[model samples]
Target: MIDAAEHRVVDCDWHYQDSFTDIVEYMEEPWKTKYEKSNWDAAGVKQNLSSFFPTSTGDRQAYGKIEREHSNYPDKAETPDRVREGMEFLDVDQSIQISHLALAMGGVQTDDERTQAFAKAHIEYMLEEVLDPDDGVYGLAPLPYSDIETSLEILDRVENEPAIKGACFITAGANPPLGNRKYDPLYKRCEEIGYPVVFHTGGSGLDDYVRAGYQEMLETHTLGFLESNMSQLVSVTCQGVPEKFPDLDIVFMESGVTYVPGLISRLEEEYLKRPEEAPLLEKRPSEYITDYYFGTQPLEVSASPDLLELCFDMLGTDRLLYASDYPHWDFDSPSTITDLPFISDEERKAILAGNAVEVFDL
Candidate 1:
């Protein structure tokens, strides 16, 4: 077995609760006052109208399909101390924290100004309240996806903060796709600042898949992540995002690694048939894909080891980063990678730590 003690294990993708109640306090005048006054409470229930996140899980908890039990200790991973304890338990040296509530910010929030305000409040809350680079906890600045100018501004705002590692582009319900020219400026800004643009997926039960009449939350939750990232992969690759910003680093989170090899093969097959369509791409789609990084949370470990080993070989072992997705229902532990019989000790160490260090410049 690969020894977790031998490496400064880095979790490239982890999530924490950015509750609206707490984030609202950091909002500016109009929004703060508006949210506070509009926030409603009842005998045994409460709701925040200003919450940017949609109610994606629906009535699963009400029916006992899911349980929300209280923990003996801090379980949200929302504070620096809680995060440090989590890292210790998982044998992780460093972690890049994503927001559990804000993961759907881009897809769910349509109001441009509200999106900007929420993004700002989230970054402010994380920077001031949660993030502690010295304690091995770091975060990505959540960007307002629709507002390019504000996104660029946020990038500049967090440029000097040591705990702010990169800009997070939520991809759950990205309209016009990520490869469009609308996102080019933000991508360019990321490249200029040496910050990788990490695309994080979210549950699609609230809007996209539901609107299409998909009743089951399980169906949407299972397929939503894969579909969202696959859509962007096609857009980013075909539109030559890598070519346009050669130095820019890209990372896709939440989705498992299995779809990558299949998607790349499909893209290459189509690219060969019609090279005229994607004129900007100088190499095969798979070739450019190998340059990007992917987080391995919700990793499909139930699959056959031989199949996984083949997938890893196709994608290159160095491109994979171990992500715990801790504090969530389906989080992976360090043993998930360490116990893999196919990967050698060195490769396991690289996946668990080394690749993340190089990807995020840790």
Candidate 2:
């Protein structure tokens, strides 16, 4: 087992997936009955989520990567014992249990009520099976991005659950981006409770741009997943989210690092020219970007060491968090991320664990 007493290593973007049937076992009362009876709204929402992110696929022609976590029923990937075993194997201290079902919910065109019900059921399962009993595991509370009130209610219900360290919502399908007035209540509440609002990777934003724009699955999958973060990060920094909730810590996960510096430079130049348009911004856009934390996954291997060093510098050495994207085929080992020759030991340690400890307030 990895000795937590000596070194701290937190996998910031660990994932858990389930089919629609697996989720029903965790639901209570009305939600349970709805799933059992196949209530059109609730059942339909669950079906879509399950189909979108299954743990295993029969397609041999499946995209580039095919490796996935073992899918033993009951003792599946996200179970407490399984997580403990995974951390031990990976030499990690803990992992933030992010919901794959919740990630799919962001882009689905579903009723607000139904989505909220699904979100609650998903979180219920996460708390029971993956988070509550495991000290080495932390959770991100899934949010129904379609309805703010229901999301708030989920947070209220899970407030005393200390294992839930952050709130997970997707901005991929968000029309107004995430900085609009509609999401103010959530930002405010998260700030009050000292929880960081994490914007994880999701897909099919704004009329399914990726699918419509690209022909090949490889083409769409590669670019589609990362584009949403760029747009939303711009919206949050440029639209003055930081100014309104100064202490609200935000995270961008699964997105690569190159675009961050490019976008910040664009925003910086724009700020110098059009300061009046975005008056809510207190400092330059890059400073706000610095205040946020980002995940190091799908690492920018194409970049030379010098370029990687420059990107890390722009990102602020302490701001990047290391993630394995574990159990997925593309998962980077903690060593692969930390073993880089260009970075110092302290920088690698910060990326591996110290930064996550501060960002999640673990």
Candidate 3:
């Protein structure tokens, strides 16, 4: 059995309830003025009107169907002090705070300039108010996927901040797929700056998944992360993204681990028969996959330990980073990995904090 007390924990996928109402002050003109004047409390408007991202009508916490200790202060991780308090409760040594409201950046339905403005404002707020690498609260700057130029500019702006670790790309509703040539400049810039690109999936964009016949949140929530990550996994590998940007570190978050083995096996089989289609890839699809890292949030605790052990062997234990996805109802705790009988003490330490320290350059 692993000694839980001695293990150092690092949460790679922590979230704060971000609201435009709070960051509105960070936003720039015309739109800022328009946002201030907009009646967010209007009747029939979605309860999450302060958010720039589309609001799904999923009843997560409504009417007390679900409950958390800090339910009232949903944005408990909004400040450095608050973030530390939450971390202390979970017994985490460090946390990389991902955006809650900013997760839907790819699904922002507006002009490119407006979308870019929101991205810039969000990063500015994070850097000024929340991000504190010294205090163990780090963050990723969200990028406007549709605007490559603006995305590059955001990278340049935050290049010097110790607390700003990487650039986050919202995977839902992302057009041109990540492997397309249009995204090369962004990928190249991230590699040059020695920052990993984190693809964080969101469940708010139900319409995107609705086309696949998922009407309820349970259906969409269960499969949304898998679908988006799987699509990008195939897209990135088939198009030789890893081949082109060899130094760039890529991470897929929120999706659970079980889908990986089956998907990679199928992808390899297809790639074997069609090598000509992907000229740049010198290795099999699964080989390039090993180079990328994945978060262990929603880690699928229900699966048998023996089955999970096979997954750990195939994917390599070092590639998995422990993520709590905290504040959200389904968040995992450090004990999830600490109590696992399959992983060795050394492997447990790596997943809890060691791998994150190397991955985020902490």
Candidate 4:
């Protein structure tokens, strides 16, 4: 059992493993053929390593790290024992493990059969690792973005699974904006079932600016969050998805909160410039943003405390959730965030646990 003190803190953003081997292991036989046809062998591994760890010496060192860390599943990195260690380190009560590969890879094949199979495999893996009989772990289900009908069906299959709290989608990489009419069926299903939709940045199989070149790594990693959030917010607001499904709750994960104030201000500015474009909005763009949820990391905690106070004051306690982003190179350690010089006890409590309870209904 989780300690009562620890149980009260909810980690809003965390990641699950997607080892290269796991993908090869879980693929269906026919799909395995397709996967193998792609460059998933040694050459593919080398290419991935080169891209993620570009420096010559750094890449060599990182190859060992990646192989050591990712070659096995339920290994030290993903074991419940290791997770408990992290929970203890963070003083967190419960954690939601969002799948990095599952969210990154949407619509493996455009056809319905392949997409459904892919989605099912992902859900099954999530259930096996994080959900099955585990007391404190929860999961966000991955939908087949390739086909809406299958996506809705997958939602229906997992909606009642107690271990599943939400559905996750790629922040980018889907054909149209998330608010596009094609996705309304999925949103409507989520609303009816009362599951929040989580949009995680850095999708798989994407060839965006970030994935294109080495120079874009710094800029890509920084700007990806802003770009995806802006695109999603604008798409949902301007396209009337919120109006269509007011009860649907969406959380933007891994994107820091510093730029949000500016985004909201800019959105309001654009709304005023062309009111007709956003006729469905009942108030300013910031109002809807305040209604939505955001997960906070250590970097976001670096924003001026005064500005942070103002933004949270407007967004209210329920709109922000705490996330440690554990195990990644950029993982935010709990101590670092909790010890930020300017944050108050009350705000710390809220960001660490209080807000997540309300947002996740834990």
Arrange candidates, best TM-score first. Answer: 3, 1, 2, 4
Model 1 stretches with alpha carbons more than 4 Å out = 40-52, 57-77, 204-207
User: TM-score of every model?
Assistant: 0.91, 0.86, 0.93, 0.81
lDDT of 4 by residue, 277-334 (tens): 7777777777777788887763566667788767666766557777877655456755
Stronger candidate by TM-score (2 vs 4): 2
Lowest lDDT 10-residue stretch of candidate 2: 52-61
Go through the candidates in order and give each one's C-alpha lDDT: 0.79, 0.72, 0.79, 0.64
- Better structure of 1 and 2 per lDDT: 1
lDDT of 3 by residue, 1-362 (tens): 56545667889998866666666678899868766666544321234454455755365564466676744334232555667888888888788888777766656656747678777887888888888777888889888878888999999999888998888887877777878899899999999999999988876576456474556667777777788888888888889989999998999898878888989989888888888999999988898887788898898888988888888888878999999988777789888898888888899999888888898999
Best by TM-score: 3
- The candidate, 1 or 2, that scores higher on TM-score is 1
| Candidate 2 C-alpha lDDT tens digits along 310-329 | 88888987999988766554
